[model samples]
Target: MSINLQKGQKIDLTKGSGGLSRIMVGLGWDEAQPAPQQSSGGFFGLFKSHSQQQIQDIDCDASAILLNANGKLYGREANDCCVYFGNLTHKSGAIRHQGDNLTGAGEGDDEQIMVDLNRVPADVAKIVFVVNIYDANVRGQHFGMIQNAFIRLVNLENNAEICKFNLSENYYGMTGMVVGEIYRYNREWKFNAIGQPVKEASRLQLLLNMYA
Candidate 1:
């Protein structure tokens, strides 16, 4: 069955009646050309330099991407941003990982985190992805301006969509996080309410407790 989703809404999976086995998480968006900040100046009066890179037409066929379990989240400009893995950690701190994509261009330009159901930690009830637009706020860079972004879950065994979450609109600060619940029932794996991007990682813990 196709999962229904709307931007800025969250779904609670703990209330679902069953458990899910293999879940595939995917991230997608409409690709838009990035505008150049300014034009280049040259000594030659006859020379005119283009300020922005040519934008490509949105590819309807590349709207979805399957995340690899070993994949890592990355920023469009790696030097300008940082990606962290946040969850229930023993150290109670975010673990930073090398970004996988830097240029926010073409298809599959966003970062993705994958979870293998069989390898999930026994104590881990959920996982979250945190995007730090800039290591410091002074730079004035953030992800709030991002558009047409979404997360999806796929059933690996059958290559089907189990659920999806949208992140197109929100008033939350630039620093944001999205979480998905893990549950088991009837010897099968199922996920629920995998929607809405949360502003805090701790909220994931709260949702897990609420549904567990």
Candidate 2:
């Protein structure tokens, strides 16, 4: 089925076919800043002043996506500011290996986590993806804006768009979190946007609750 997403909306994938035992988790964002550098010192300031140096923006576009597939959780750096895929084991969580390209230029950045339905463990029920903004606070500087970020599930068997979550905007430079579930009855994957604009602390708590 085609997945429809609204700004700041959540979708759950666990209700889907029990067939989806494994899946991938992906994360991506846009970088809207230019490179930064230090400025020359004045005659009165013999040494370069730390205050005069420009701090680089925290680019969330280049962060590693974290997930819990089976009993074990896994993480891997994104290839670009786009799509990535990982193998999910029900017990271990996710086994991420290769990354994909979902830059979202004109087409949009589309990152994904692939799950093999047959490999899921009985105790494991869902998958979570936490979108992290790389270097959020550096030299007391904050990352500016993060918009139009999201996560989705692609059915490897039929090549269908099963579930999705949309994170259209975040004002506080906080991270984004989305959760997906693999249902045992219908054999279909379900997804939901759990928290919009969630901070690092909240995200960590959620992950701990789910995995721990």
Candidate 3:
């Protein structure tokens, strides 16, 4: 059985079981269905159904922000350490993004990041996972329109489930979320569930807040 994580929960990545070297971080979500509109009709019109608009294809991107012990980002050669669709792999070959999903339509993981725990640089102390709509403001999208959002860490070595976090809160005006973080603690890596929502214009602004 996997550990079901709640907000503010923390787990040591390298403890309990044997040493964990490789792991996959998977994030998933589905576009929420809009509620039906109500139209006034006859005396029995209360149960009448109004036309429902098709749900727009909202694009949600997953990104990994690699930071050093000082909580600062080092630019990757291609994508400048902000590993995402634009930049799939880091210079160190430690963290690599699977790809981008234009819409959260289907099932399973919409985006995934593979982390070779042993390959991570010594100076690099943290990896922050963030999910944000590509053009939230322009598209008028928010987390409120997202459903079944979750993040899970799996042991790639044997495909054993480590931990999983389901974002069970309703966010109405927030465009992005700092889903979680894996940081170095006592020389061992640990995962923290931080489902903090931010209404930033872009992902860059959210990164700045982590440093601030």
| Minimal lDDT window, size 10, model 3 | 40-49
Error of model 3, residue 162, in angstroms: 0.6
Ranking by TM-score: 3, 2, 1
lDDT of all predictions, in order shown?
0.38, 0.42, 0.82
- Regions of model 2 farther than 4 Å from truth: 6-26, 33-94, 97-111, 139-144, 176-189, 201-212
Q: Residue-wise lDDT of candidate 3 within 78-152, one digit each (tens)?
A: 355578888889888999999999997788889999999889888888998999887877766788888899999
| Model 3: number of backbone collisions | 2
Worst 10 residues of 1 by lDDT: 59-68
Error of 2 at 185 (Å): 7.2
Candidate 2 — number of clashing residue pairs? 48
Error of 2 at 147 (Å): 2.0
Clashes of each: 12, 48, 2
Candidate maximizing lDDT? 3
lDDT over C-alpha atoms for residue 77 of model 2 = 25
Superposed model 1: Cα runs more than 4 Å off: 7-20, 29-99, 136-138, 179-212
Please give, for residues 134-185, the per-residue lDDT of candidate 2 as tens digits. 4343322222344455566666666666656655544454543433333333
